[model samples]
Target: MRAHLPLRLTRTAAFAAVCVTLAALAHSLGGGTGPDPWAAGVGLAVVFALAMALSGTERSTTTINATLVVTQLGLHELFGGDGSAYVAAHQHGRGLGDALGMLLAHLTATLVTGCWLARGEAALWAMLRRLARRLVLLRPVATAPLPPAAPIAHVRDVPRRLLFRHSVARRGPPLPA
Candidate 1:
């Protein structure tokens, strides 16, 4: 059903869903202070960044470039310590330092993911150019063998016929005065 949504809307909704799901998961575990929730968030960032990089193939990629990154950061900060993460941190009795640490980790992950994406974009661009060049060189142009000639056929010798097949009896024209 979500497929019906516009791409941007779907991705925005998915981002929201991720944030909500992460919060819910933290809550389920009694708070954002799980053993290494930030690590999990890092993994999520990696997946998200990879998806964004792969999505470079789409036309919308250019339009939604900054939006994607901003969304990730906003969601990260929102779900970070003292924000949505607070709920989990409070419940788990995690110290302020830990919460801050977790936030730091998330920030680092986001930045790293973004950097990886930058590198990935350059690499893909170079690879695409290389691929295009190779394709052009390897393309079977004049080097391709010609197809066998087809057998010729004799033309039909049918004579032209009048549209009206039956001849009408000629009515004698009235003598001109």
Candidate 2:
């Protein structure tokens, strides 16, 4: 358990960093002319790949999605975007409600793409998961501990002797008689 602490922490930190970075990029690109469609597609592809690679389970995917939403909202509040104006001009809304509504609308679209990407990844990695299971299943079995023996009345058997002539038998110390 202790050994896994650093790995978990590293994964968490890295995911957070990516979320923040992506949020900032999204907020920045979402401003002004509302980003080029090509750019948006490329960005979505990057997000899909990142989410698929980092998210291990449904819970993790939910957490990451939440993180992305929250980070984007926070950055939008701090840096301020023209989303309100854009929404009021194009869509039929205004003010904070409009902004939030637009945000939610975009969130739905983004999440759909993410879901598609995750499903694709699941299909692709199914084979990898099976391979992993096979590797574990095929691993060499550890030798069982020898049972304790009663005190020997006679010493006919040598106390220590090589159990087998092959190098494979030397993988561990020889078992006692």
Candidate 3:
């Protein structure tokens, strides 16, 4: 269980966005009017954020799909407006067609979102694995200690004349132009 804190937080944010957007769209289309859209969006965000945090990284496609489906259903119900209005709408012969349409839309959205998140998860994990491999390969290797430096000869004892002998002769001063 790698601590993918950034990835987890990002996924949480994406999930929240999806939840709020889809729920709001579905609610409006279904003729459900809510008092506060901002409150609904924030509520969805907080709920999904907590869900994602508890669920951890969803690496499996099936798991992602399942999670998304549940989330969509929850959001749909949440934004479905007041119970009295919902009951009145249904009582007035709002048949199965609307319900079916909403379900279908939610399912479609879930599948698409799940596929996208799964693909991204796979790519990110693959990149992380490659980076880990490269880092391991770059580890410093242990080697035998370098040989000690040779001792310097005592140059102070050498005669200065001998050292200077055979040295380059001093150049004469340049002739006047």
Reference-based lDDT, each prediction:
0.51, 0.53, 0.69
Residue-wise C-alpha lDDT for candidate 1, range 1-177, written one tens digit per residue:
112225434443444445435443544454424434664566456545644444424323333445445655554444444654565554334677876765665455445544554465556456767887898999877767789999899899988688767867778888899
- Would you estimate the TM-scores of all the predictions? 0.35, 0.39, 0.64
Q: What residue runs in model 1 are displaced by over 4 Å at the alpha carbon?
A: 1-69, 77-104, 142-177
As for model 3, its CA RMSD to the true structure in angstroms is 8.3
Winner of 1 and 3 under TM-score:
3
Give me the displacement of residue 159 in model 1, in angstroms.
60
For residues 41-159, what per-residue lDDT tens digits would candidate 3 score against the true structure? 66676667765765464468887677777777676666655667765653334578865765677688779877887787778778878899999889998999999999988766755
Ranking by lDDT: 3, 2, 1
The true-versus-predicted C-alpha distance at residue 142 of model 3, in Å, is 3.6
The lDDT, on a scale of 0 to 1, for candidate 3 is 0.69
Ranking by TM-score: 3, 2, 1
The deviation in Å at residue 34 for candidate 1 is 7.8
On residues 114-175, what C-alpha lDDT tens digit does candidate 2 reach at each position? 45544644454566567778999999999999999988797487565566544463377778
Q: Could you say which candidate leads in TM-score?
A: 3
Whichever of 2 and 3 has more TM-score, that candidate is: 3
In TM-score terms, candidate 1 sits at 0.35
lDDT score at residue 142, model 3, on the 0-100 scale: 90
